[model samples]
Target: MGGTVVRQEILGGVAVLTLSNPPVNALGHGLRAAIDSALEAALANDSVRAVVLAAEGKVFVGGADISEFGTPPRAPLLPDVLDRLDGAGKPVVAAIYGAALGGGLELALACHARVVGPKAKLGLPEVKLGLIPGAGGTQRLPRLVGPESAFAMMLSGEPVDAKKAVAMGLADALETGDLVEAARTHALKLAEGGAPVRVRDRGERLDPATRAGFETKATEAVKKAPGQPNVAALADVVRAGFDLPFEEAVKTERTRFLALVDDPRSKALRYAFFAERETARVPGLSKETPRREIASAAVIGAGTMGGGIALCFANAGIPVTVIETEQEALDRGLARMRATYASSVKRGSLSEAAMEERLGRITGAVGLDNAAQADIVVEAAFEEMGIKETIFSALSRIAKPGAILATNTSYLDIDRIADATDRPGDVLGLHFFSPANVMRLVEVVRAARTAPDALATGNDLARRLGKLPVTVGVCFGFVGNRMLARRSAAGERLLLAGALPHEVDAAVTEFGFRMGPFAMSDLAGLDIGWRTRKATGGKAPVADALCEAGRLGQKTGKGFYLYPEGARTGSRDPEVEALIERTSAEHGITRRSFSPDEIVARLMLPMVNEGARILEEGIAARPGDIDTIWLNGYNWPAWRGGPMHWADSLGLAAVAADLDRFAEESGDETLRPAPLLARLAQEGKRFSDWGGR
Candidate 1:
């Protein structure tokens, strides 16, 4: 198994070609060559009547070699190897364990039959990376499992467990015992029937019933992704499998796959896929860095965010104590959490017993000292500085010496909060986004005096709790929200200059954001920002007046738009339009029509400018970190990449020019292109060109 990707063993007249690559046995060029060599040896041997394809690692074959992407195709491609298996003189069965995904599943599908281990997962999840299956997945999958099930699997891009694989006929059998032995027996049985039949030649599942509603399903698939064309491309390829000859359909799929390889959306998704891994690489920290043990945890406060934080620990199977100042508030928070869990159970997302088990991990108590028992305590109190300072001061006095102290602050200064505690090394920011249990992005803010071990613990625990940890330097709003503030400011400018909330939201949503800044603000409540603005001596004329009129948001059934009869979707209200025009007049601003493209540019480009500032200030390590944060925390479209990547794709010079023009037009110096952005534009460089400081 040393440096060998495939090991061939002739046992009981069946050649077992075992993939020996550790970790995920990705089908690199060498591995594909080794597989071909093994297959040749098996077919050449007179004693070998059948073949069992297996692997030594957890996964049989993970997928393609991502490192080989954007490069020339090597010799003996996966499709070639799969084609050899399809027309092999001897029967071949794939023994899949752990996972057989992407090209790996395509390889398995090419075999005469498949034996899946109990722990096996099978899928063709290429659509997730904004590409369809290139190696005959769209063709063979439908032939084996029928078009409807195959389309559902490919479009959803979710893996099916072993049980479901057998049920769907994707897997020939579920092997509870040794997978390779089962595969050997299955291959021998298939060989007894004569030469193996290729999956592409099978028409058993191509009945008219499978084709019913296929047109509607294909349309639905295209509708799933509005702005993105990859899904539509995938749907077209899958439809070609149903309508055209197998050979012709495969050619169609290949053409589509090759085209998608150069698609901006696919490239962005691929970049994001690598970027998430890059975020784990800390600059000053090494793999040997000590991480403080995080066993039991505590969350200070039982509000919406605080309860969500507690749920995160509970879901991770870590017992967490939720501390509240009063029993009533604690009870309310716990009840709300239970209701949320109950809804998940009702939707069949979680079992009743599992909900109870998760709930049992969360304990509610009414005191600051209750946090002292936990190894790490997160203060998810109000976003106000005084409240955070008071909690930290109390935490410093009550918490154990080695325990980590974290603040779940979105925008406040973490260093100032850490200054309240004597052990600033143990104090860091764990900025969990709203609905913390659900959001994956957790900003691990390193304070001025944060110890390496303490920072390491935050990153470690975040991963353990199934979160994307983007380590950021202490700054106002850190990376995501700091950039969000710039966008919010720009959005406000758009509203004051004649663009309505609905117009701005429409522009953003069309640009691939799930919701626009105005709609998101309304949903989050106009009062939240109004209170913050009032508290900070800041003014937002239109929003402040809306809040003053008690038009909070969807809860109040009115805000920037009308949500009549408690509707979630809002309709534009003439009163709000009048309010915006009146506000523009009051502010001595001229009203002008804004095209959707201009509205999108006005809002998004400023965030790109702020991202440049963030990178220059070392607030974020790299462009990817900002993208990962925004992608997870802010509903930034995965296809478009992040704000910085979007800017780089737009070209730095174009962005810099646009920002300069916007600044000049608006007479807003703050809207001017950042120094780093201006310099990068002048130097003909992209943000991705930076070495992340």
Candidate 2:
């Protein structure tokens, strides 16, 4: 006989309530109602002296169903259900396995006792969604594990394992074998002994000094993230717990949580959460699409990019061979890799043994012959087409059949590169961002003739390397850099028109970017872009002047800004300002002061326009894919939900009007509103509302 989502059974007078919702068993309305009903039944049954709450899935309730957020209220809300579970007349034990996160952890906290398997993880991660724990997590967690521990866990949104959970008193015990049975026994023992223990009744007090220390740390964390409303809200909610009564603190947390749930930052963060997951679902690729096993990998070139790419493989426990053209270059690459690991170890981010193990997985050689054993070969050579073609041609001859060949090209023609190889079907782009080991994004560029399995393999490899992979069609700069070029172009014009480097950067940073374009240029070195511009015969007069004057950024202690010796931060440079003014006069540009708002509009609108073009041109499969690339790769603020979503939130009509204004002001046709953007604006539509072409 079929049963409700929550099934109750009597085992030695202990009522075992098993949450039977499929998949993640999220606590939605129906499941919440079922759980309440089961609890009521267990409470009334004379034979049931205690209760054991278990879940019939790999995870013991993966928290609230995110889809249910912002929807109409349902009876027996999560907090109420948790209260009912906590206040049950009989003792209750939570048998936690897999993950107990957010509402899941709150549910466990509500129980009299929590028994977790060794592999289980517990955390309250609502802060990541721009909301605090609404259902008493802020108040109760501090009661279990003091404010300091609770503050760090909630702020970072990272889960603690069963051992840590027990150590912190989040879980009463670690039952590695048969969690449900052990939990039932524990509950029965509790029932036989006395009345149930209540988490709410445990009033753990914190010393004034310890409370002040936690408050200071939380304040600093909030200060570090300037414009993120959730950070400040989290700090406020956590601090409130210290001063307010238990029930009063919970009420405050609930009020703050609900307010944040309706907040723009929260909405954006939630959108980004879903958008990231949506990016993985390629339109045409079926679940059955064959993905090749990548047991061994090879990376060509031993430059910075190549070394970082090699580290990605090694970190994933995949053996990698790095091929360089010369023995000297090979040694230099190995040295760079070792230095990076040593630095990480010194920072306490990595253990010496772990670093050594990762280092051991990597081997360096001087030729393509070493690539024969690799299941996947990633060419991280120079961006020149000739060099890439030569490497691909050599790889085609050397690599084993069925081996997936990938290029770590940022902005190059993948089809042309594939044409150089014999197995065009096996060729695709695995465009890892600079410092590949650190950056989470990897643009999986799908070439014209690339096979489905090749694309699948690239996606699989990216996941293994802990990278967010966004599949895109071949194009100049693909999705991210293509749109970035538009933003950079606008920033350059802003520099010449009147704004100095600091002004432009300040405007963008104030708008929620980590760094301004010019400031970032200084750190990356202006010579890099200057070289690319020179090769393409591109003109950015101020940038060219800076390069010509031997002010090539931090390396030279000057570029758009000046830096002192041994200092990373740059200061305003009058020489750069003079050069910009002179360049503006030479170009017959009338200089005018730009407000921060104007600067942001001019810089960002062009990117939105370019993104519209990218979507219309089929370069990106969906608007969300474009957003994903910007969020992960380009440092787009998560709370803004990426440029496309941000534009949608701003209203497409207003964005289109801004684009038109920018085009007219700058006399740059490239800033003209794309036809798709204009149409959507006219129709009162949005990029997020696009149903996909």
Candidate 3:
């Protein structure tokens, strides 16, 4: 009775069982056991006509305690506890708020009724963690809401609001105003004279015609989902409702759930799930480090990155001042922003009023003086040291005291930029991915002189903007694109050495990268590399010739491969092949055949090697940080567990040996295995094993 779940007496014939776990109130062993005991007591009491289940804090229950995912689950698994709850003759109502997800949603489904407030969100999000609903959710949800809606919820992992839940019949009734009071009132009504409500008995919605439609829709949905097995399994579980009895359906659900838990994809997804939470934690940093409150922010340029940065702030309801040097350039940037918002509106994501609200939050101006009032100033100007230094010097003099100065530099000297400011401690790098408003990653680069408060403030700001923040140290490239330099270079050599663009692209795409490297390159345009080459002082003759032939990328109708005019498909282009042959001959580099295995090996080994160097050099705090960067930013396949995880699977020692062989054959110093890689290989350890211990 004294354990976490407290059974407290309320009004006449109503008892309250409160789940009081901290953080997300995840139903762990203790909470699950407490729930079982409390339900037994509630059912025993003749006076306790009804019961209301609620959490003591913000959420009803977020999900399974992810900490307990890989380990043996604690007592009375959520499904079993929920089964006992479903069998309770006395009515039980779930008072829903915050995120009711995965097992949490299953528990709510087991209740006789659910009372969710307007602010509450409900979801079965196990799909994201590579799992399907195990605990009667797949069975009961389809019975209540039908298989079509259930399939969408399970496959997409999107949260539904109270209004939607009620509209779809997922909730018996939506709660109004105070959630707890409404839940109590609902329970009191059931206690007084209402008929018994059981989720399994909701057969009117699962009629023959409706069930047929659900099956048809579910068949179409699973075909579209990336992987087949889990979604198919979910559809099968839902199908059991018509073929088997309710109890039998639940047993089938549990058996399938356990099977999914054993799956490799599920393990990888679950590992990534915990890794994301772990990314927020850094060992040496004290929690006491002050985080500056960022009320308003500013972007110092009006280019693509700058405009996206401004939109990110606007999305967070933070007023942003965007500064540009010229009116035409500013108008162009604003036009890009307008087009972006228009696309969102067309997709039904942004209401016209909401778009106006976000647009109204941004103020475009021609002077840096307006930045003086901002709490945080992000410089996303052209990647040039002289220009960045000059702007920072001007900003250091004008910006409000205690304001955090951030650079949106993809790969530049954060320390040098910090040196440009008088308050070096206030300067840090916030490397937001391209199209900043859309990308989920923000590499927060820490300079040596950067203050703890500055780092904490940037990290907090990234979180507030709905982005993952991975702390990185100053280097040529921080964590992601820096290591990406090696991968990109590898991709270039692979293409030059007789492997066609499609061959290389196919290899990575088959390996689960959303796009092949060359395909991505074409989308990014061949001109960006031309600019980079000019900036670094060299001519990449092959790409230069490709650009000269009006082959920019998909936008220009061709780049590496020809695209049917205005279409996004690939075709072999003889002109590009001729250019490659000429370039190869000019360099006296003989073209040779390469296998898909070789293509993947060459492209990924550099990333693994550089990751090891990053680990040893402390540019990245941990190997997982590097993996997080790739997973969130670069579209590294989640199931493979990012690049570092993939490296672990391949064996670091094996990768090191491959690198050594590559270096010997290629005669390139960069191809030589990094010492850290060699050491780990020798020790038979993974980069993950060689973590920041």
For model 1, give the 10-residue run with minimal summed lDDT: 1-10
TM-score of 3: 0.91
Candidate 2 colliding pairs? none
lDDT agreement of model 3 with the native: 0.83
> How does each model score on lDDT?
0.89, 0.89, 0.83
Model 1, 1-693: lDDT tens per residue? 323788778889999988987689888888888888889888989999999989987888888887887899988988888888887899999999889999999999999999999999998888778788999999899898888888889988899999999998899899898778889999989989998898999977776677776667888867867756678887788788767888898889888888889999888887877788899998789989998888999999899999999999999999999999999999999999999899999999999999999999999999998988789999998879999999999999999989999998887889999999999999999999888989888999999999999999999999999998999999878998788877877888889998988889998888998888877887999888887777668777788899999999998999988998989989999999998898899889999999999998898999998888898888888899999998889989989988889999999999989988998998889878889999889999999988755
Give the per-residue lDDT digits (tens) of candidate 3, residues 582-685: 78777778999988888999999898889888888888877778888898999988877778888888888788789888888778788778888888788888
Q: If scored against the real structure, what TM-score would every candidate get?
A: 0.94, 0.97, 0.91
Residues 320-375, model 2: lDDT tens digits: 99999899999999999999999999999999999999999999999899999899
Any residue pairs clashing in model 1, and if so which?
none
For model 2, the stretches where C-alpha displacement exceeds 4 angstroms are 1-3
